[model samples]
Target: MSFNEIKQHSKARFKCESNELASIREYVRLKGLSLGLSEEEAFKVSLAVDEACSNLVKHAKKRSLSENGFYICLKIYSDQNQFIVEILDKSQPFNPNSVPSPDMQEYFKQFKRGGLGIHIMRSLIDDIAYFPAKIDKDYNVLQLKKLIA
Candidate 1:
């Protein structure tokens, strides 16, 4: 669906600190379950969001709404078939293409600690899209979609 259409649907915005991650995860989890997702499916949704927020807390250097805080806007859209989640943040813009798909065998051999969030998001969600923040806009937008099975 178009971004405008998605934004017009059910949505919520969160401005919180790193410690507030659990609350955001719970919100997504409950929304997923309430929307009829199986527990496992809802957990996946929660985990994906958790990973995204964690990345921001770890890497983003932007000034928060309050000291040591960050802002995230979540927009949820539904139809007869699927659910779409859009997460917007003021984190640094990322070039998804610049990060190559990790080699699982090599990753295990090196025991890497980073670069796994994107992989997990891709694996659990049906589709993932990243939009860099434009010069005119101060936020990066990441969209995750999961199709009902």
Candidate 2:
């Protein structure tokens, strides 16, 4: 089936804030367990969700968007064999693909300041897809999916 045809099993929205990270992680972890994911698997998904939200907060601040004005919506859907988690943010439009893969040698050698969130997100999830803001729309959606074990 196509991406658009999947039925949403559950969803939740939270403000983009450092304080909300724990809540967001718990939200994803509970949903993951409900979907029959093992604790390890659920933790992996939760970490990915956490990283995404953290990155959004940083992005919003960089763009000068008010902390209270930024928000994230998370949708959990199943396609018979896997669970898909979609994270929507209305901060600033960015091309996730434009981020070059960091050279680990340099990143570690030079003591990088901040360039690992995307890497962690990619490593924890089975599949990651990003949607840029539409011509008239104000939000961008980042999708993370993990296959049922």
Candidate 3:
């Protein structure tokens, strides 16, 4: 079925586990395609989601020795021209502006090896916005927006 057939919001909670990162990538890619995104666009969207989830898995510590207590949610919503993916993480309140974006020219010149997940994720999508958790809200949200072409 086409994405418009559903029209309702699409959302999923990706288990913050290393092994599940692949699943998250596939889910996002297929969903993007179903939403009529071009193949290249779908791949880019998936890559961005994968990078975000990979970072989450890399830093996720087992809370309370139980695996069932953790999940980073991915909520998808769309407008006429935009598909938005919002990732909700419970770890810390983050301000995306606080981190300096690396210069691609300088980074390539230096042959940087790691620590570019955020940069990559930012590049793949059309827009990104961060909303830190409020007193009532326990989880901070990272929103990735891909414009449907």
Candidate 4:
């Protein structure tokens, strides 16, 4: 399919795992490039999306009840010069903005190994948002967007 075709596309649901993240990244990169993104911009979008997917894998594993794994939906828009990646998982709801800003001084003292995912994602993407799923309401929704040239 062509780039314009993809821009008009939207998938309602899909499942993914940590191992499958690479393929998803590649797919987003190609779609971004086709929509006029520079290689560097495409890479940034891919990496941001990968981080979101990885978060789902790390946090949602225990909550998954069936073989479906985690659900993801991607929407690409050329006219908008942007791509939206939405991930849904049965993990506890987390507000990215609510995460304590990283403190380098406390990092070593408190011995917290992780909590940088949101920081990295925010830096890479044009926008990020979190929302509680409306129905089948156990899941949390993470939305990310990156702008292309």
- Give the Cα lDDT of each candidate: 0.74, 0.83, 0.76, 0.70
* Model 1 lDDT, residue 75, Cα: 75
Per-residue C-alpha lDDT of model 1 across residues 54-97, encoded as one tens digit per residue: 77777665633334336788877765466677788776676443
Candidate 3 lDDT, 25-126, residue by residue in tens: 887888888877889998999898888777767665532123543688887777667676778877656555467889889999999887798888888989
What is the full ranking by lDDT, best candidate first? 2, 3, 1, 4
Which of candidates 2 and 4 is the stronger one according to TM-score? 2
Residue 64 accuracy (lDDT) in model 4: 61
Query: Where does model 3 exceed 4 Å of error?
Result: 1-8, 62-69, 108-111
Q: Name model 2 segments beyond 4 Å from true.
A: 64-68
Preferred candidate (TM-score higher): 1 or 4: 1
TM-score of each: 0.82, 0.89, 0.82, 0.74
How do the residues 1-149 of candidate 4 rate in per-residue lDDT, one tens digit apiece?
44435445444344656777888788878877877778998898888877777777776667565555466665555556566666666555666767766877888899888877777788888878788755557566677767655
Instruction: Candidate 1: list runs displaced more than 4 Å.
Output: 1-9, 62-69
Q: Where does model 4 exceed 4 Å of error?
A: 1-7, 10-14, 65-69, 108-112, 136-139
**TM-score between model 4 and native:** 0.74
lDDT of 3 at 83: 72
Q: Model 2: per-residue lDDT, tens digit, 1-149?
A: 88779879888988888899999999999888998788999999999999888888777767533454478889998766788898988766665656887989998999988878888887888888888766786678888999889
Q: Rank the candidates by TM-score, best first.
A: 2, 1, 3, 4
